[model samples]
Target: MAKLGAPPMPWQKYVSDVALEIDPDTGLFAHREVGLSVSRQQGKTELTLGAQVHRALAWPRQNIVYAAQTRGMARQRWEDEFWEKISSSDLAKMARIRKSNGNEAILWGRTRSRMGITANTEKAGHGPPLDLGFIDEAFAHEDDRLEQAFSPAMLTRAMAQLWWASAGGTTKSVWLNKKRENGRRLVEALWEALAVDLSAPRPRACYFEWFAPDDMDRADPATWRATLPALGFTVTEEVIAAELEKMDPAEFDRAYLNRTRRPTPPTDPNVPKGKWPGLLDAASKPVASSVALAIDVSQDRNRSAISAASLRPDGRVHLEVVAYRPGTDWVVPAVARLHRLWKPVAVAVASGSPAASLIDDLVTAGIDVPKDKANPERGDLAVMRSGDVTEACGQLADAMNQGTVRHLDQVPLTAAVNGARTRRQGDAWTLDRTNSLVDISPLCAATWARWALVIRGPHVIEDYDIADSFA
Candidate 1:
């Protein structure tokens, strides 16, 4: 990045570490889809340029596409931004620009590589196999037709990677929204499976988002510091304060906070009357030799819960809310401490839930939650997918009804159980934390812990602490 005359920021380098990782086995890109959703004016254009320029110079005969909101705007950018930068630099001798009216491209004669500028459309991804694809201003896209068009061409290229960079999108941004959700789930699944259980299949997407949740105090400088990567460089707290004063609240959120509003979720569900209180035993404790731990974070990112589950001597599962704490910064060290105290069979969390946010932090804490997709039940980090989540929810409800589970009479756990709500995942239903009246992290943590234990019954615990190596 320094060679390109624009030194990259820490966050940009951080994104590159994960998204640009090459798989040693395949000697190719580890992830097919790479995305970044962040606050506006965080050097996304420069970041995109760096990737496109590097790929063009590094690879031979690479077919790359850079699409913006429209063809005219794309061409304007190519002439004003990209060409000017490349031409003024040392790359001028090796580069060639074709600026014919409707169709324009940047060409490298020696490598025969060409980057075409276009408006993102259903046909933006057409022609010969695409080595790399860029969807600039990705939030403008309203549907998946372009992605549908891009997938086929990417299939033939062993090192193909599609990049999407955008600020948070509006409700009309169905394409970016789907990618955001899927990428979040994939990150959750990928880190757990790859880091914890190497034998598990890998996820195809790599994503990073630096944006505050919609509920955060946007007017605060602290909020801006957390979300805006360009702080102290291209951006400043004073400037942000000015933006807040001048801009509309929602627009300020979109431009500066990079927050998008979502449609309201389903109303509270009728939780099953499964003798919840009757199953509570003041003396209830896990008697199983091996333990399983689960973690959950609230949607607001305000609170977190860590729960343990193990079997009772008589056969019933024992569940306990071990920790309920404010904020998520302590979750990693807390889990690491617990793992040493109890060599759990699996550390489980729902794949697509808010708790998934912890996957990366846990990995950085020297905790590996690799996935063996073929044998999820046998892994150290049990990635509870939508199906697995629904199954676990059903299992918990059934166990409560059948009096096969015992829980310590914890206040937080009881409140979570009483206030929990369910939403259909497909044919089955999973806990809906967002729609619940009260915090549901306690219920979520216990449910996943119980499921992980039951699924991997009577396992030999891995005695070593994964986090200890880092320490």
Candidate 2:
């Protein structure tokens, strides 16, 4: 079999060094466990693909697996783009390409290496031992089941090289969330119970997590460039200034800056979209028999907002927000005004932190507050009621996609929505700490809790369908 050649690109060379340091004999890296937390578009794909080709050429009779979160993503990224580059390259032909079943099974005879891709389904990933494996977008797969299920096959090929690459997800899971949460709790419990768990080192396992050095500097493109040294991809001041002018703040945060933000609300493009036509004007007419007020609080000191979401008997909900500046305690008085003006049937305040305090103060002051707790269970209900986050994000994405959810319509609220990031914890979800966007949940929770007032027509009932739905 012909030997595989070294990579020519700088990025490839760096990865080559890493591979050689791990498995020098085969000039291939089989990471028993390795994590690559890289910034977006930093040539992760290029390096990985180059490495795959080099390994296949250098090591004959080897099996390689490439995988991603979804089949479509896997096909487009690895099988389509990366595979094309490898097969078209002179190096690929040098190794001799043989295919069976329309390239499903590819054999490079000169190097005795074969490569195949499997969709990220349980059935698709089932296979015999593999000499090398690749996982893309590992962050997108929160459950870790993919790693658990797929790694066994690769491990059976004990002599093979295994590499797991991903842009590590935001910290909100049981494993990676803040140390105060489940991850830390688990460590405490295990140490107390077994005592030896922490001290002992397990064979064939090494854990390494690499994050950007300055977590606080995510907004700077130079910070991103530092994570990706091989690309020669620098965010020049001119390019950044131009981007800031053209892209919305949300897009800038998510796409270029990698900042997590609030999701855009979806809208139907076929409908003629315009201003809400002065929600207060509609409210002044006293057309509605009852009102449901949902109030969301701010974690940061700068902004506190209350959104009045009125639900008519017809089942359509209307939203009008009255936001306030930091250090201003307007939530209770606002509720008072809402009560006197709209005669809202129920008031709901998010049930935690300053919000919960506000709810208590309102109740003590004789302003009735139905339970306004932001129950994780309620968020789950929202998911079930509206389907997945992707489905909900569709409308927000649509308005952005269709040019309908614009700045002119509601600039402040839209901007707030753009700064949120969500991660699923064990049976719960959380907003990213770095995100400064306002949360609608406290208000939504208050609104959901006030549904009882809706049915009773402004009368406070201790219990209602909304409360019971999650109870």
Candidate 3:
């Protein structure tokens, strides 16, 4: 409902005025979560940052958290951008803003109110309890992980509003896709397909998605306006045109137009004809305490190669390969041989295939094939994988640069590793096709599982020894 006589805005209205109503009294929305998808240069970041500041200013002793993907981003925001603005702005003159080494802050105002800020890790985000939070580029995070990270900010005295903003992502499963299609359906049929009743116990949270229509001709401005509500007036036509012109056609559609292209279900890149590296083939010595395992699936016409290596205690990972033989079920038998010889506690198979039946077969054969979901919180399997792979990749890169890690005589795996280039996917790294061995995904998964069983807590490496096969 409009206030009795809300003044008209010459430029744009405030976020509170235009935002969905959560609570009727405070004019504060009580959404469990809020998602916003806007095209680039539409003031999404500004709106979100302003909202955080507003919340902090409105309430005294409020604890606010603004999180990006990495510590560099964290520092960039506080040291380079936000705090710089605060120091320069009249707001700093009016308020007493105290900041610590790139992490904490205390803002005191004339109203005798204070606002604090902190960076949160995966395990700690949901631990502290929070008043308000801002998640920039939320599409990149795994499902529910953002919620966990923002859990600390839910302890506000009055109300807590979590603001998430992003442009678009490549995958359909991302939260951004849901927000774009499901928030408000056009017709009853479309509604049935996309809409969820907001009244559910875990209500469909409020979200706003802004993008150009898929079919819109890029040359026409009118066609763009229909899709990008932020255009002109606020976003300005010139800026939008420049951005569109700069992007590739496909990328433009996905990022700016919000068009869904047939996603290619993440295919494994073509591996060049090459030899497999042996354990003794290392050009350099292993890290202080490290483990590596090779997984070969046994199936006719479905031989897959996967290798995972990680350091003990430190959650670093190096994924070696994921190659498949076109016609032969060699994976199962090969994996069995590797198991008998090396006794690796963890081996990841790409069960998201016909091979899933084989996983059942393996379980029947007394092989451990537990679903990844049933894992620890702090010791989450996904966390371990991501952490380990990142660490491993970094270590591997350093070794390569320093001539530390040498391939046993230059095998296919060595060639692949040498040719590997990192692709940026949000805050994480995805293997670019050129040097990929079989696939990097499975290797990453196996490394994470290995870390959970090995370096986590008091557990030792569980008698899995490849050294006995030395003979």
| Per-residue C-alpha lDDT of model 1 across residues 1-471, encoded as one tens digit per residue | 655567789888788777778899888888888999998889887788888887888889998888777777778777899888888887888889988875678898888998887666788777889988888777888887667777788898898898988998788888888888887887788778788778897777878888887446787788999999999988888888998999977788888888775443333444554487688787877754657889999989999999988765566778899899999989889998877667677789888888898888777765566655445443367778888888888888877777877887677887788778887877778888777868999999998998878766544444423222112
Q: Let me know the TM-score candidate 2 reaches against the reference structure.
A: 0.45
Please, what are the lDDT tens digits per residue for candidate 2 over residues 1-471? 012222344544555564545544454343454445444555567767765776676666778877787766776675567656666666565543343433464567776677777665555446667767777776555465555556677765655655655543453322222211332354456557567566553223222222443233444656545544443543355665576578875555444444333455444232222333222233331224444454555565344555544433333334445444454377667666666676555554433434554665666555642344232211111111222222323333333334322122233443344334544444444333244344534333323333323333323323333322112
TM-score for each candidate, following the candidate numbering:
0.56, 0.45, 0.46
Say which prediction, candidate 1 or candidate 3, comes out ahead on TM-score.
Answer: 1
Per-candidate Cα lDDT values, in order, are 0.79, 0.47, 0.49
RMSD of each: 16.3, 15.2, 19.4
* Better-scoring candidate (TM-score), 2 or 3: 3
**Higher-ranked by TM-score: 1 or 2:** 1
353-467 per-residue lDDT for model 3 (tens digits) = 3344456545445456344444322211122344454554443343344332223332335433434446654565644533443333333333333333343322334343422
| Order by lDDT, highest first | 1, 3, 2
RMSD from true fold, candidate 2 = 15.2
Q: Among these predicted structures, which one has the highest lDDT?
A: 1
Q: How far is candidate 3 from the true structure (C-alpha RMSD, Å)?
A: 19.4
